[model samples]
Target: MSAMAAPREHDGADEHLMELPSMRNPDPPPPPLPAAPPRRGLNFHPAVYVGFWITLSSATILFNKWILSTCEFAFPIFLTTWHLVFATAATQLLARTTDLLDGRHRVKMTGRIYLRAIMPIGLFFSLSLICSNKAYIYLSVAFIQMLKATTPVAVLVASWALSLSTPSLRTLGNVALIVVGVIIASWGEIALDATGVIYQVLGICFEATRLVMVQRLLSANEYKMDPLVSLYYFAPVCALINGAFFLVLEAGQISWVNDVMGKVGLPMLTLNACVAFALNVSVVFLIGRTSSLVLTLCGVLKDILLVVLSILIWQTEVTLLQFIGYSIALAGLVWYKLGPEKVLEHLVLLKQAAMEGRALGVVAVGVVTVLLVGVVWYAFSGPEGGGV
Candidate 1:
C-alpha cells in the first residue's frame, strides 16, 4: 500500500510540473540565416582612373573662381546661372544621344510623376549646387574642402534622423575623427576669417543632406533608371528654375552675362561648361558605384589637387600651419576611406540585393554607366581650360 501511494504522489507531482508554463518545452534552436557571399574585389585600377576624374573636378572650381575674378559678373548668382544653363544643355544632349544609341529611349513619364519625383530631385540638386557654390564664393578652397570633409557625418546624422538607417558606434567614431580634423584644419583660418567659416559650414550641411537624399531616393525607387537619366531629369529643371530666378531677381543685371562670357575665349568658356557637366555626371555615377564615404574621399583628393593648383596657378601663399592642416585633413580622409565604415550603407545594400537576384535590373542599368561616364569625361576634357 505505501509503495502504491508513493507512486501516485510522484505521478501527481509530474503532472503538476507538466501543467506549469516553463515545463511546456525547452528553448528552441535559432533559425539559421543564409550565408552571405563574399564581396567581389573592386579593381584598384579603376581608382587610378578615378583619381584623374577627381582632378578634373577640382580644376573646375578654380576655373569658376578665375572667371568670377576676371569678369564683371554678379558673383555667386552669375557663376551659378551659367553653370546651371550649360549643365542642363549638356545633360539633355548626352542623355538623349545615349538613349538613341542604345535604342532604349523610354518616353518621358507624364502626369504626377514629374511633380512628385522629377522636380523635387532637380530642385534639391540645384539647391545643393548653388549653396556649395555660394559658400565657395566666401570661403577658401581649403576651408571649404576641410569643412566638406565632415559630409559623411552629416549624411549619417541625416539618415538616422529620417529613420532610413540605424546609427552605429563605428559611424560615431568616424564622425568624431572628422570633426576633430575639421576643427584642427580650420582653427587658425576661422580665427582670421569668421564669415568664411560660417559659409563653409553651411555648405557642408547642405551638401551632406543632398548626398543622403540622393542615395535614399536612388536606393528606394528608380534603381532601373540610368545614372545619366537623373542628370537629364534634373538639369533642365534646374536651368528653368534658375532662369526664372534670374529673370525675377536680376532682370536688369543681364549685361553681366556678356561681361562674364567675354573674359574667356569661346573655347575656354565651352571647356568650363563641359567640365561642369562632366563633373556633375561623374559625381552621380560614382555615388551609385560606391559609398558616400568613398565619394567624399575622392572629394578630399580633389581638394588636395585644388590646393596644389591654387599654389601654382593663383600664386596663393601657404604657411607651415596650413600645410600641416592640409596634411592632417588628407590623412583623416585616407583613414576614413580605408576603415571598414560605410557612410551610405544603402549603396552596399543595393549591391547585395543585386547579388541575391532581388535587384538585378539595378545592376544591369549600371553596367554601361562607367563606360558612358568615361566617354563624356574624355570628350569634355582639353587644354583650353586651366581649371574649373
Candidate 2:
C-alpha cells in the first residue's frame, strides 16, 4: 500500500511539473494603465502611440509641403493616390511575410462587411484627402493650422450627433475655446482664401464622419489594437478609391516627364508615402487604445507644435494677435483636458497639503509630467545650433 501511494504521488508531481511553463505567459508584461507612470520608447502605451501619430503626422505635412510648394509637383491627387498605393503594398507584404499581424482575423477584401462598412468610409476618406491636398494650393501652412484647430469642435459635435460620444458641457465649452482661437486666427489670416476655407471645412466634415464610422466599425472588445491590422484592411480600399479619383481627375493632364516625381523625385515621394503609412498605423493604434477626445487633444497639441515648426522651418509670418490667440487656445485646451473637477481636485489636494502634510502624490505626478515633457521636447525640437 505504501509503495502504491508513493507511485501515485510521484505521478501527480510529474503532471504538475509538466504544466508549469504552460501556466504562465513568456512574453513581457504589457505597459501599464494611464494612471500609472508612463514608460517611453516604442511600448504599447497610449502616449507612445499618440507620440508616433504626432511625429509621423508632422513629418507628412512638412514633406508634402516640400513636394507641393518647393518641388512644384503640381499633382496633389497623384501624390495622395501614390501614398495609398504604397501603404497597401507595404501592409500586404508585411502581413504575408511576417508574424506581426498574425492573429488579426486575416480578413478578406471581398466581404459584405467590407462593402457595407468600409466602402463608405473609403469614399469619404478619398474626398477628405483630395480636398485637404487641394486646400494646400490656396492656403498657407499657418492658415491651414489655424483652421485645423476647429477639428476637435467638429469631431465632438459630429460625435454627439452620431451618438459616438457623450461629452459633458464642460468639454463642449473647452472645445469652444478652440473654436474661438481658430476664429481669431482666421480673422488674422493675412491672405484669406475662400476656396481654401471651403475645401478645408468639407474635408473636416468628411474626416469627422470617417472617424465616427471607424468607431462604429471597429470599436469591439475582442479586436487586437494592432495598427498594422487596420492598415491591412483599410489600405486596399482607400487605394482603390483614390486610384479611381486619380485616374479620373489627374491621369490625362499630368506631365510625367516634367513633373518632379518623374525627374528623380520618385524616391522622395516613396519615402513620404512610407512616413504616411506609418502615420496611418499610429492613427489606428491611438484610436484603438484611446478615446476620440484624447485623439482630439493629441491633434490640438500637434497643431501647436506644427505652428512653432511653421515659424521655424517654413519662415511663415506670424502676427502678435495670432500668437496671443493661439496661446489662449492652448491654455483652454489644457484646462479642458484637466476639467473643472480634476483641477478642483488637484487644488484641494494642494490646499490640504498646505494645511497638513500629505503631498507626495501631487508632487510626484507634477515632477514626472515635467520631466517627461522636457525629455520629449528636447528629443523632437531637433539640434539647437542657431538662434534668431
Candidate 3:
C-alpha cells in the first residue's frame, strides 16, 4: 500500500511538469508582417490631370466639328466608325505594350458577361456618338452645348428607371429646372434645326442609358475597371457596331472619300483620331486624381468656354435669351450637384460674411441680385431684348 501511494504521487508530479512546459513556452507569435513597399511613380498635381482632360476633351469636340462641318465631310457614321476603330487599335496596343491597362486583369470578364453587359452598353455608346456627330452638322456649337446641359437630368431619370437610385421628388424638381432652362434656350435659337434637336436629344438619351448601365456594372467588385480598361472592352464592340452602320448607311456615298481626303487631308483626320483616343486616356487620369464634384464643375466650365469659342471662331449666333437660359441651366446644374444642404451651407456662410462686413461677400450678393433683376426685366421687355 505504501509503494502504490508513492508511484501515484510521482505520476501527479509528472503531470504538473508537463503543464509547466506549455505555460513557459507557448508557440512564438507570428513573425512581424513584412512592411509594405512604398508606391512608385511620379505624383502629378490634381490641376495637371484636370487641365489635361479639359484640353483633350475640348480639342476632340472642336476637331470633330471642324472635320464634319467646316471641312464638309458630312458622313457622321463614317467618322464615328473611324474614331472607334482607332480607339480599338490604340487600346489593344497599349494593353500589349504597357502596364496602363493592368487593371483589366482583375476584372472577371467572360464571354457571357461581355455579350450581356458590354455589348448593350456598346450599342448605346455607338448611337450616342453617331447622333452627336450628326447634330454638329446642323446645329451651332453653342446651342448643342446648351442642349447638353440637360444631360444630368436625363441621367438621373435613367438611373431611376434602372432602379439604381430611388426616385426622389426633390431631386426630380431640381432637374426640372434644367429642362425648363433648356426649353427656353431652344425657343430662343436663331437657327434652330428640328432635325438637329432631335438627333441631339436622342444622343443625350442614349448616353444617359449607357451611363446607368455602366453604373450597374461597376456596382460589382469583380466588374470594376478603370476608364482605360473600360475602353479596351468597349471600343472593340462599338467599333464593330459602328462599322456595320457605316456600311449600311454611308458606304454608298463613295464621293465622300475624295472630299474628305482632299479637303480635310489624311493627316488631319489621323490627328483627329489620335486626339479622340487621347481624351479617353486623359479621362482615366482625371478620374483617378479628382472627385466627381471637380469633374462636374470642370465640365460646366468647358461647356461655357466652348460656347464663347464658338462665338469667336464660327461666328455662332447666341441671342440674349439663349444666354439667360443657359445661365439658368448652369445654375440649376450646380445646385443639383451640390445638393440643397450644401447650397444652404454656402448661403449660411455668405450670411456670416455679410454680417462680418466682408466686401467680397457684399459685392457678390449685390452682383447676383442686380443680374437677376436685369434678367427678369430683359425677359419681359420685347423681341429686341432677346435678339442676337
The candidate maximizing TM-score is 3
Candidate 2 residue lDDT tens string, 1-388? 0001111111000110000000010011121112122224445866777677677777787777777766767677788788777877887787788665663663443478778977887787777777777777777666687775565466567667776556567567767787787777677666688998998888777766665565555444333224456556666787799888888988998876778547427678778887776665544344435643455445555666666666567556655556556656655554555555665776687678756755765664575467445433442453642121
* TM-scores for every candidate against the unseen true structure: 0.65, 0.71, 0.80
lDDT of each: 0.49, 0.58, 0.69
Model 3, residue 312: what's the lDDT? 57
Candidate 3 lDDT over 211-231, as tens digits, reads 667766765667756556777
Q: Would you list the rank order by lDDT, best first?
A: 3, 2, 1
Worst 10 residues of 3 by lDDT: 16-25
Instruction: Evaluate candidate 2 by giving its C-alpha RMSD to the native, one decimal.
Output: 14.3
Considering only N, C-alpha and C atoms within 3 Å, which residue pairs clash in candidate 2? Answer: none
Better of 1 and 2 by TM-score: 2
Residue 386 of candidate 1: its Cα lDDT? 21
- Residue runs of model 1 more than 4 Å from their true location after superposition: 1-48, 70-72, 99-110, 190-192, 224-226, 254-258, 261-267, 280-299, 340-388
Clashing residue pairs in candidate 3 are none
RMSD of 1: 19.8
lDDT of 2 at 232: 65
